[model samples]
Target: MADRLTGQPFTTRSEIIAQHGMAATSQPLATQVAIDILKQGGNAIDAAIAANALLGLVEPTGSGIGGDLFAIIWDAQSQQLFGLNGSGRSPISLPLNYFSQQKLTAIPAFGPLSVSTPGTVDAWYEMHQKFGSLSMATLFQPTIDYAEQGFPMTETISIEMALSAKHLQGFPNFAQTYMPNGMTPTKGTLFKNPHLANTLKHIAKYGRNGFYKGDIAKTISRYMKDNGGFLNEEDLSQHKSEWVTPISTHYRGFDVWELPPNGQGIAVLQILNMLEQHDISRMGFGSEALIHTVIETIKLVYEDRAKFYCDPDFNHIPIKTLLSKDYAQKRNALIHYKANLQVGSGMSGSHHIGQNLSALNHGDTVYLTTADKQGNMVSLIQSNYRGMGSGMTPTNLGFVLQNRGQLFSLHPQDHNVYQPNKRPFNTIIPAFVTQNDKPWLSFGVMGGPVQPQMQVQILMNLIDFKMNLQEAGDAPRFLHAGTSQPTGKKMTQGGYISLESGFSASVMQGLIDRGHDIQDLSGEFGGYQAIAWNDKKQVYFGASESRKDGQASGY
Candidate 1:
């Protein structure tokens, strides 16, 4: 039995009936939305769509209708995983020549130019048309109600909004919508977004067309034209989310799955492949040796991402070659047992030798996971690129546009150079692990570029060190910013790693001795949500990060 806060058996592990289907997310309202959908006899897709819609309302900064979405859906009946790529492409009118003519180095911060095709609504409709068993009206009611009626402000939402308040100052619509009185809403305050409510009502009535081709589109395009943005009606009308196959790799006795190029899923697979070379279980959980190995692997994968990963439509990602076991083995062999080398120093024969990785700080992304009684599962992640995204809110739209275009390189000759209709490099990566063709876990971490690193470490903690879902997510983490040539050949700033509250002082000291710059973090790093199926007991156990105000609930 699990003990309660007061030492009473508030709920027994045995008394808890394992409803084969469950839902968990970074916001309680979103979780409730999924649960409500399930109770209304909706399938996994319906519940997931419902939850996702509500998340945009409850956690506006983390995600919104204006952002991109990615998902890996497991069809329990078909025994296959399907990938949904809802990321938007650049505007057709945004030509390469335009940048040259304007002498623009990079995409602007906000207004209309920063907006992509806005495929999120279209993607949600696509998923529903193919897999959902509920009416679009039913799926959207929860979100509409939350927006119209009101919801209590959560501390996590409050703190993040407050931190990014400066960015919000520039956009009048954003200020009026989120910080109505020009003040951050305190926790427990009842916040309502009538504009968003009207928007949701429009979506529910006209399907995705409501947003893509009707009044909403006209309103948005008009706002962009009036405010120096580049988006137009054609960009919105031509957008369509693609359904692609997910990439997978076997680890130990399980098959790990993630989405393809344009996402950092391959990086997650690469990190796992590298760690598979050693008997990480023997290192013990939270041990310095294990932590060191994980950190080093993260550095390698992130280096690859910074140098190579981009939209598959634009660049050949070489995912198959990179994730192959043979390649991982070759890369893993370079790690020296006793010393930590500077980032990019361990690459054996890679050509891009001298390039330095940037120390860019990112904010705002949302993650959610779901499973149905029929065994259907989905691990979904979405983001607006930055908080209040680009800080450009269209008048009366009740949402901020994403600044994803900032991810593109400014150099005209670079492969990731800014171009019209090109999707920028993205950091949102959602993952799943299965044993014998059955999903054992569906999980994700919400952060900017740090997502892949966090996912890899959590997987290691669970599969390698045999920790529970909570423990794995609760473990201390380290991030390698890679080498920067700001000063000289001195490996930029090597360590600057983040250690969670639970790590021992000795472990921290060991990392310091290993030439790592360490920093102590207090619950400000990231949020993880997971659903692990206990095969033996035939029950599903869900855990949400305690660092955030989230909940894991099951029916």
Candidate 2:
């Protein structure tokens, strides 16, 4: 019954997994947890929060309650998407002169100074208060159980644990908790964190006060005091998440949406607009021409991003001008074939306008997308900035705080310069797309600068190449790195575009012949998870990237 050459029968067929309601996440258990919540009468928002909590437990390297959260919720009842910026601000006590006094050229990556007040907890409470149908207690119990009772660790997490163990060895109890045996465990190992369980249990029962005002707050403040961190009880108590409107740009008859600045979601829209001028479908995937165009287009977009994107509260952001078709056209005029050009920011017409940006932008992160039977959908992403975060574990609280401060620039006039109680430009953004005022796709790819690039590729794969969700995610991707740093870092010589393994040798040479710098690499492409609704069929299709250990299913 099997075709020996292609192994047809035995091989898994990558199809759009269809169901009445669907869930897709970077962890199989998280996806199952979400579906369970939906089946129990919870809406997409409820399932999303539940799934995110579980993901923190199952994939601690990529995320945890100690990090930040950004979400885009598709509320079927209201028929509108909601954006929440759950990112925290830098310490108020740390003024602009702090870095100067410390003789620091760049912000430190680890310890107290790097930690922003944890925002995921506040985000969870905000979203739940607005949309959750299930009790918070009910939603958190499963993850608390998993954290309390040891669960089998996945291979990828094990590898990450071993890699990050050295940086974490110095943090209090990090070694004792994560590496009980004084060394990171291998795959198939059982790991547990009763400390995290207690933390979640307290939050579930007492809500925001449990984490922000009580023992949790005390623990964080004490750790900062003892370790030269500026965070205090005041900072914890003052923490709040903002609800904002989502922005959009039209592409090929569909409206792609993303959260505005302090997020690079604007850059994603800019990239789509720049590439829209080219006939991508005709050029095709893996073509040197397509790759060259995208790389150049992204370079131009990021150039504007570095100089303008920042926290709007701290800077004047010309959101409208940056996303204007005129701006995209102006940037698109810079692309030159056969020569890798170093690009920077462009003015929005005759006037200089502010752009959107985020910090702690690069990180190991997790994305979850959910859709319920009622047509409600959610695209949510959370991150700790870097793998294992800032390596600063508070006394016995059992989670790493994000190194978001690293994104703050020391340049006095920079839009993203260090500021008291100001949120950094955030990189972990969730995205959704709608067509004709109806929900289309809810998806996100997790990585630092790679997120926006991967997202564009996914859309192009689906729209231009006509690939199914699974195929789009599985297809080989091109990653351009060291391109443009919005934080004011000087542009390096020339950034290289890395190609995944599946590209033919001729394609590789073809890119080089076009004066593009190419590299053979593995593992920088983002982990993608998405759910698309087909209104005509009245079914939902889910997809999970083959690059990650994840699952996508519907019911």
Best by TM-score: 2
Candidate 2 deviation (Cα RMSD):
3.4
| TM-score attained by model 1 | 0.91
lDDT of 2 by residue, 81-118 (tens): 99999998888787878878899766777777788878
Instruction: Give the Å error, residue 229, model 1.
Output: 1.3
Candidate 1: segments with Cα more than 4 A from true spot:
1-17, 96-113, 338-359, 482-495, 520-524
Q: Estimate, for each residue in 451-514, the C-alpha lDDT of model 1 and write its tens digit.
A: 7778878888788767677667765666655432211112344435776665678988897788
Model 2 lowest lDDT segment of ten:
349-358
Report the number of the highest-lDDT candidate.
2
- Span of ten consecutive residues with least summed lDDT in model 1: 8-17
lDDT of each: 0.76, 0.82
Q: Tell how far residue 252 is off in model 1, in angstroms.
A: 1.2
Any residue pairs clashing in model 2, and if so which? 306-486, 309-356, 309-357, 310-357, 358-425, 358-426, 359-425
